[model samples]
Target: MGLDWAYFRRPYEELHDRHDAAERQEYLVGRQPTAAAHLAELAPLRKREPIPASGYTGDDERLWQIMKLYALSRVSDYLIELFCPAGDPPPGFGVTGGRAVMEGSTTHRLELGGWQINATPGWIGSRRLELDELAAYTGFFTDIGLTPFEHAETFSPFHHEIFAVMQDPSATRVILEEVLWPGFWFGDLLFSRAGVRVRAPRHLIDAAVATTSTLYFTFSREPRPTSDLSHNWGSNSQWRTSFHRFYSDEDGLHLNWDGQVDIGEDPPQQPADQSDDPNPLDQRRELLLHRCFVRSALPRDEDDRFPYDDRLSLTTAEWPLRPESIVRVPWTR
Candidate 1:
């Protein structure tokens, strides 16, 4: 049987709605800062106009807008970290550096590293330089503001939770239509990594099932997992990445799965008496999802840079809620 979209759509939609209401309530009550004000303040720094979308052409304008909005949101987060007093650390995360201080009665300034610098100095001075540096590498600076520790424990997982929900179909639509698209369309432009969106909840489920099926079919051959030949066949980490391509037609979504099955070096010959012993160098398969999504169907020269070959492909027959079919194509040399 193929992928079942109906089975997962309901739960995903409910979770998405709950998330949206929670976010709205958070913003309304002043628990979360408004995105509009932040974007307006940083408007002058944007470098590009919004990429317009004519037909689908596999280039989704909304997806690009989502990326831009996400970037802006990160910048806003960094600014909060820079100027506001540090709040209580999230669970498993700790803060080391002292909280940021605001100075100057008439012209407020940001004080970090125990020294104060003019916050709104002219476009070409030290203040601009600081802002530029923060904008260019928002993630790095945000990490610095959070803690001096090198471990992942220093950062909060709140954004990740939101992202996980965003991948769901109901959540994806809500976010694309309500939250992200609005921010992208009406808000000031900013920098973004790419114009693609991946990990839509349904797409993710498809990728996982396809990957598992591939592994199962591959293992069920002459060299079965329970067979002695399986002993000689060592497995290495599996790299799995997914991306989405949009279409104007009925099949509006294409979820692509690229996976690499690493075949490790031959294991050392075991003593015939100890054949049942486990190989110390036995490798485990690890899956890595490359989160990047492209902006258009136009051929990119960098596509050749992908380390894995196209192993599995799946696409929906209808937009939004239909089940997806696994596309089978003949292998090429």
Candidate 2:
């Protein structure tokens, strides 16, 4: 008995009140014409000025703008696998049996298990608004100078990306609150991360999870069944690969920078047969499975998966914690 259908069909970069980011960048070049012809060879470096405002005269032109943001991050990874298609969706996409709670204000809309989860990106209306108008038609990366960020105070899985947690257990720490999307770097190379919403601290979470109303990396507020592998590449070598960064610093949290995920400075414990962990799945159960917002078991690597998966699972598990009532879990360790 849940049928609003997020208003039939919305995201073509929004209309009604007018927002068209060039029709979501021409609907990603009419849906991936070889990553939209190498994202049209960066259209004259997105009309120049990513950094040359009298800067970077040498060092090979700042290593040629980090190799043109690693070839425009392979058209932002084939435009988020042609619009967020990784895993878990369709067992009732946004089935609103209600109950998952929290409606407005914090803007999370969030809910899980009872299944209503979302972290904004098109909110089930326009396929995650094509990664928020393809990150504002790729300007967020600052046209290539790189820096585009978005913070939420604290909850570092090496630059957020949790999506929702909300379980107080007295809330001693791990309280970010919100930040739907925005991550960029290219220098330290953490190309993407920001997508938060947390509260956490219930003997280390497994009860309050969030997200998966069709979300994985980015895009999918509607238009479910997504897929990647650059749809099998070779169509111009999938626009030129390399650009799934998640690195961090001060010495840790490199979620996957081609060393193939799991670098860590924390988050690497829980293994009571969470499928006997294997094949490089650490960083503390992948930051306690994104601090328990389960879309579980991923690190099997299609980029990353298999740290554990049952689509979702975690709870109480033989409880025996209370580190001075956790004022910290800075992503475990």
Give each model's whole-structure lDDT. 0.24, 0.38
- Writing each residue's lDDT as its tens digit, candidate 1 over 51-99 gives 2323123354334333333343333333322322223322322111121
lDDT (Cα, 0-100) at 204 in candidate 2: 48
TM-score for each model: 0.19, 0.25
Return the clash pairs for model 1, or none.
167-201, 238-286
TM-score of 2: 0.25
- Candidate 2 Cα outliers beyond 4 Å, as residue runs: 1-22, 34-62, 70-156, 159-169, 172-189, 201-333
The sequence of per-residue lDDT tens digits that candidate 2 reaches over residues 233-300 is 66444433333334444433333322212223224343354443443433334433343223323222
Please tell me which predicted candidate would have the highest lDDT against the true structure: 2
As a whole number from 0 to 100, the lDDT of residue 61 in candidate 1 is 39
